[model samples]
Target: MQNRSPSRRTVLTCATAVAAGAAGVVGVTAGPAVAQRRDSRLKNILARMSIEAKIGQLFVPYFYGASATSPSRLDQERNLEELGVRTVAELIAKYHIGGVIYFSGWTNNIHDPHQIAELSNGVQRASLALPTPVPSLISIDQEHGVNVRIGSGATQLPGAMALGAGRSLSDARTAARISGTELAALGIHQNFAPVADVNVNPANPIINIRSFGADPRAVGRMVAAQVTGYQRSGVVACAKHFPGHGDTGEDSHTGLPVITHTREEWERIDAPPFKAAIAAGVDSIMTAHLQVPALDPSNEPATLSPAILRGVLRDELGFDGVIVTDALNMQGVRTKYGDDRVPVLALKAGADQLLFPPDIGVAYNGVLAAVRTGEITEGRLDESVLRVLRLKDKAGLLSGSPYASRREVDRVVGARGHRLTAARIAERTTTLLVNEGGALPLRGRQRRLLVVGASPAFPTDDTRTTVPELARAFDGLGFRTTRLATGREPDSAKIDEAVAAARGRDAVVVTTDNVDAASPQRTLVSRLLATGVPVVHLAVRNPYDIAHLGDVPASLASYCWTEVELHAAARVIAGRVEPCGRLPVPVQRADDPDKVLFRSGHGLSYGTV
Candidate 1:
């Protein structure tokens, strides 16, 4: 397995490594005119790159561990199985991979800002040692809010829906700027963020809170603002899950989701945000795994559909920046085809980068074999190569030593100023959905309070603090608060215990998430309301949690469960701050989801407390 093609290992001796803008980010328009303006260094490097090397420039995959030399046990097994390499250094030298992605899970590569900086420098060192050296494009999913990749030491901003609820484009820009600055300080150059999906479906299991909102125009504006912020912060912003994945009920990681929209409906609903992204000169766009039948009746996932990628995204939308596929290893892209065919299909379908291929050896060799057999033209490969090279140049990755000053990282990431920005944005996202009988503004600050119900740590974050955030915030504000943790969906035993705890408290705060409308969590809310203590329910994940629990005395929707959001919700309950955020997405009935319970922009504000 250690033996490779002569093209890979034979280049170990001496190869001329040529060392290599953002109007450079726009579409490939001019032929000779644009070629004339291209940097001499870039042209030289391209001219000298072998067929093997140019194909290498199109592949970006993830490797395990925090170091390039020492492979984690999982990394050793996976890398050895795939490429017969034990370390990232070996992987780089052997495969000539163009980039590496950092992920929070699936063998976890991030620890803290300093550790990330170190790991990034190590990866760069190995990549630069290649016979034809080029800096690796280090990327992450640091979308902030719920999908934050780095924890503990990095500032975590509220998610995109929180911004939509807040309805502030400037706040959204600030969040992106802070995230970009922090990530760039740790040597990460690209953020797969600003989830441009306009989430119109409450049953959407994946993109609900990640999307900005249900309104296509508003979501487009928010995405544009984020793109501007991230690029100005010197980090490339990637507008993701193209052709929209917000209206689907299934998770693409597990199964393929088919979107049935007419061409006109798609133009009205899904095309606006991506249009806004391209107009803002977003550096990259990620193809989704879902199928939009209007774009292509062939039933190919957008990642493997020429009609969707080349016809729609490239030709119609005029997005000539790097078109990256959403992880090739996903079942959505691989269920019909094996790993070998997926990479070749994606490139032919118009993807510039094949992200996280299941097997690097198969993907690399498959494309190589295709090019040799005249199936994939060298001109087609160069089209992607130029786009990628321009992106690298725009990101300043072409410069040497993509490393951060370790001492400065501590000061730059999670700074006091950034956290304050996060808190302010979070405070603005607090929406008063139901304040029946004026049951909120909890009257007095000094009272016995029971903070209970299921939020389940923002629904997917592994780095959530164990201390109950609502209880802690209320405790700080002079309430004698008791916290009761119900699982994401409360069980009968937990509901009964919570109801019993509510008996003696002056007020009970119940926070529910995406549990079923008729579950024990609903029983918990009912039993707490039965106690006749002022029940202030907080829908801490989705606003629809308040759709069925409408009988409660009061309800609020923070649309998030982060510490900052919980703190802001606590302040609203205490009347320390007015509830100002509006619902970004309309609330449908939990029992009958088609019925509108609360329209978008439905939020109540207390005039004078």
Candidate 2:
């Protein structure tokens, strides 16, 4: 044997070089079996595809309702035939289009998941019947919890913040697994969910309830568990708003949101959850239209920035997955770069899929022109195509898996098990912020009880479920309830007057609607506290409102103004349920707020006797 292992120095140097190269190649390569399968699939599909069909595959358009009022209405039956759905079967029959993402507005009725599934199946079946084989990548935003779109038959799980408050990774995983199982049962292979954004900004308008919590580690752990659960249930979970949209103050739906943090902060706070999700094998990553000047000096949003998506996420974070864009029609991209040009820019910027494009034809043509002009190479397109096909294959679409039946859809979407899970979460997440003199668990036969807040009416916003409905859950709980509204600070004097009127009454429950703006409502809380009335402060918004109340007898932080929280609050106040909710975010001091207020584990508990 002529020293087959070689000298120590030579071996060490070669091993180090190989390690470095392997790290670099991780996200770039498709691997041996994956590459071979991709090559074979691509060749088989491409041989039957026309130039138009190939171009169509490059553009994944948004399909709105059948009306012309909306952006694009897929004349599915016609488009399927034209795209060569009349030809072969596998995945690429007529159009090699990567995927289709369903939204609420696209359906005949937003509440009807069955109707949506029927329409979706119709399209998928058409694709299957095509002469040239092509399987469809059907996707939807089924992020159970707050951002639920498919509502009618779907389980309404607590929001991400609620899950964070539960302090259980298992809770997050179960929520995702159940949601994924339900979505899969409805023929939805992809879920644009388990938002990996680490919510660091309290002023983040859009991502508040959508984010799990402010802590990167907690968010990361939850995301990993959720992604694993979804994948295990045979649904492709996409960790979204990549490179993190957690620190922005503005909503991307309205305009471009910017994060002014340094790269170090970005990696530490914002990127950890995404890193965790990627490590946990998230099938896809959805890019946000956010401007992080420190990460990409080009001033372009992450969705259209190769620096953030290709360099940071794919390279630095080592994520080898599909990179899908948020709705291209949104103002975040449309205002900065015109609607017509965003598709080409997104593709050139390394986005594998363009979601909800305003004009599919224009986008398709633009990408084709870019490839022809050498802006986006054929190799790049192939890479994206391969990734799309691989995901479809993993989803069992490539093998012509049978569509989920209506009974199966119903069994999973709003099953008894999922609802019970939601109820359990609701029971656990209700928190009590203040209880002085032990005024809570109000004793027997209280003659009068007052409830005060905004309008005392149901929230008119379609997005929110009402609070009064939940308050009704405590109808026979040994107290007569009175509802009132403390309109403004000047109204606080009126509230004081009302409290004086109800003096010697059993208890005064002053419901405070904590708006984003800091108002003079602190005076009202102080007045109630001064009177020695058993004051119970109920915050409908941020839990930080607790810091304003000076030694109130009893206080509760509902986090949300929804009906579920309202009912849960009633039970907690009535001593029917213990306050098990931990603070998801810090409750900072009103006068001198700390960067991090109450730590993650701060929660009140009323144990069973």
lDDT of each: 0.81, 0.67
Alpha-carbon runs more than 4 Å astray in model 1 = 1-36, 71-75, 458-467
Indicate the residue-level lDDT of 500 in model 2. 73
| Weakest lDDT window of 10 consecutive positions for candidate 1 | 1-10
Q: Best by lDDT, which number?
A: 1
Per-residue CA lDDT of model 1 for 100-127, tens digit only, reads 8887666557766677787887777777
Pick the TM-score winner: 1
Candidates' RMSD to native: 4.8, 10.6
Off by over 4 Å in 2: 1-35, 58-60, 66-98, 105-109, 129-133, 444-451, 454-465, 476-514, 517-533, 548-551, 561-566, 595-597, 607-609
Q: Model 1: what TM-score?
A: 0.92
Q: What TM-scores do the predictions have?
A: 0.92, 0.81
Error of 2 at 114 (Å): 2.6
